[model samples]
Target: MTRTNLSDIISCLSGYDPDAMSVTQARQVINDFVPPLATFEKLAIRSALDRVLAQDIVSGINVPANDNSAMDGYALRGDDLPASGERTLPVVATIHAGQHYAHNVSAGTCVRIMTGAVMPDGCDTVIPQELTHAATDGAVTIPAGAVKTGDNRRRAGEDLRTGQTALRRGKILRPADIGMLASLGVAEVAVQRRLRVAFFSTGDELRSVGEVLTPGCVYDSNRYTLYGMLKRLGCEMLDMGVINDDPAALEAAFRRAAEDADAVITSGGVSVGAADYTKQIMQQLGDMSFWKIGMRPGRPMAFGRIASGDKEAYLFGLPGNPVAVMISFYFIVRDALLHMMGAEQAPLPRLQVVSRSAIRKRPGRTEYQRGILSADDDGIWRVRLTGEQGSGILRSMSDANCIVVLNDDQGNVASGDLVQVVLFDGLV
Candidate 1:
């Protein structure tokens, strides 16, 4: 099925205004307009890292499979321990992880157990080896308060029960997820196919990395940055290089990209200052919206779908400025593309922090300022702007660890005022 049109979705919202779209409103529209692709691939569990699960993984058996000891210690019945002070018990047999004790543990006696070893029958408590004192006659003394009943024991099916869902569908697999599957004895998994994304820059003045640059031309950095971002997101990226602003070249590039990829990202030519032909050509080939979003840096954006004969691909037309391209890609296109890849990821949290300095901002627009988060003298985390907030300044993005988000209705931020920030890097 095709995605819902933006106009149809906008009509559902109260007091909808297209000319001045809020960040939240824009996001909602995009969410409604984009749907997950329906394709899956089978992959080995180890190779499925960062891939979205296509089906729920139901546990065939309990995770531990049997009741086991969580520590190298003595396992005995709780009723056998003295109420206070200490109790001495005879050690029946030693249980290693791979082997089991054949006989049930008798009353007032304990079985020496290693970590992950099966808990002897009739034993409900464990005292670590360090917490117990061994007597001359192979008896072990455990202090009254050393452990409670069922202490240091891992119950069967505690982590995962048989016939229960171990991992849900649409979840992006991570290291912990892979390890969990391994523990479940799952060697392979079904995952959504990787998304194929084609991107390019649209400027005659832009040159490739190895190409000799003219006096007025600059090397294209957007393609390199786009490559890194898409690669990190586990996408199959097709860097289409720089397509000149000429009509024939632009149309040919768009057609080829739509035919080969699930999505196309182009930088430049959507802004009002550019040739009117940019929007005209886009509309001629597909259904698109040229929007002036109520945001700083990345105000101009074209979002819709383009067709090449029978094939079609989603299009994201970003601004020409370096920082604007990155900002727009992160805030607007990233989530939509992830959805296309069939990944159900939680939204990046916007954490609140105090601003270290004053920032001038106008109301009715959201601002994304690159910032460095640091601890103050009192160890309170605060954010400071990395440098100039100009959209053309790429170094600001590089030096920043986070992005200070100023709300659409909010004005200038005074020093020490609480502001919302989204971290670029996080400890997983």
Candidate 2:
């Protein structure tokens, strides 16, 4: 498929300004630029957990297959019920689950039925066993108004009808979905191939684990965090170790990543700095854009598609600070990757809760403050900041259970004020 030029996409967005792009605008650009992968692979339902469906699953037969009893009771015609007194009906037959009663149930006669047992030919209702009293002469007594027609009877195709779409395309299959597919007698299904993401960290002052930490160098923690996040999203990852601050090395890394994966994510060198060579390399390689986004902690970001000879890949250049990298990724890159994987993407829900402390903020920029959410004595949900809010403070991200989102127009938040927050439970 032919990809739309990044410039063309940008030109179409009204008031599109890279220098002062809002979080919403940046997300829209990425959404419009990334396209879902068309390639798909068929896999057994047992192995298809968390995979996006490539095709709709049409049911071949009705679920339950026949009109069945939903309760262990006596099945009889609804008209046989008494107007104001008890009615006794002779028990003609007993049917268990997986059994079919072929004889018609005549008026004043009932069949003892177990759950999942097919209803008798003339039975249209079932009075639950608990509501019926047994008689000595092989009969059961049902009280007036005990049940109405169709009460405890499950109609055929109630769950899924023949030729109906049981599951739609772009669904991320879960355990329940697997069970549903099994109920439909589907052994295998077509799902979109996993998204390939190549990520790396860049800095001369960065060292991998097991390496001796020099005076000015720090151990690289970004790659490990990136790995955790991408793994949770079920992406196939390529972790290219820390690249040095050199033009040639940066260019080679970008080319290799673009050629090898469907998308490339780099941690450093996007921000304005003398030693930052990643931005230059990205611009030289593809249609990249460097922007100072209107968000705190992660203001500087780069996004575009980079090419490596015949192969091309989308690029996301995040900030060097640890906290900034995570915030940028979760807010910016996560949805784009899901789209590329052909999965249905929904916005992460932001819950409104009261803040327990005063927060410093401004009106023009958005801020994502790490916060701990808890229930008060009154069982009301509340959030408090995780001490200092610094872009480089990785510990803040760990201690917090949610991120308090302050919109661009929102200013300082006072104690007891309500704010919007996104939880990190399934996300982080």
Which portions of model 1 miss their true places by more than 4 Å?
1-3, 135-137, 274-276, 426-428
Whole-model Cα lDDT per candidate? 0.88, 0.93
Rate residue 318 of model 1 by lDDT: 89
Q: Lowest summed-lDDT stretch of 10 residues in model 1?
A: 272-281
Backbone clash pairs for candidate 2 read: none
Give the 10-residue window scoring lowest on summed lDDT in candidate 2. 131-140
Residue-level lDDT tens digits of model 2 in 279-304: 88898999988888999889999999
Off by over 4 Å in 2: 135-137
Best candidate, lDDT-wise?
A: 2
Question: For residues 1-428, could you state the per-residue lDDT of candidate 1 as single tens digits?
Answer: 56566567777977666678777877777778777889998999989998999999999999899999999888999888778999889987888998988788989999888999988889988889998886433788888888888789899999999999999999989999999999999999999999999999988899999999999999899998899889888899999999887898889999999899999999999977555356677888998877888998899888888899999998999888999999988888888888898888678899899999999999999999999998888989999999799999999999999999998889999999999999998411
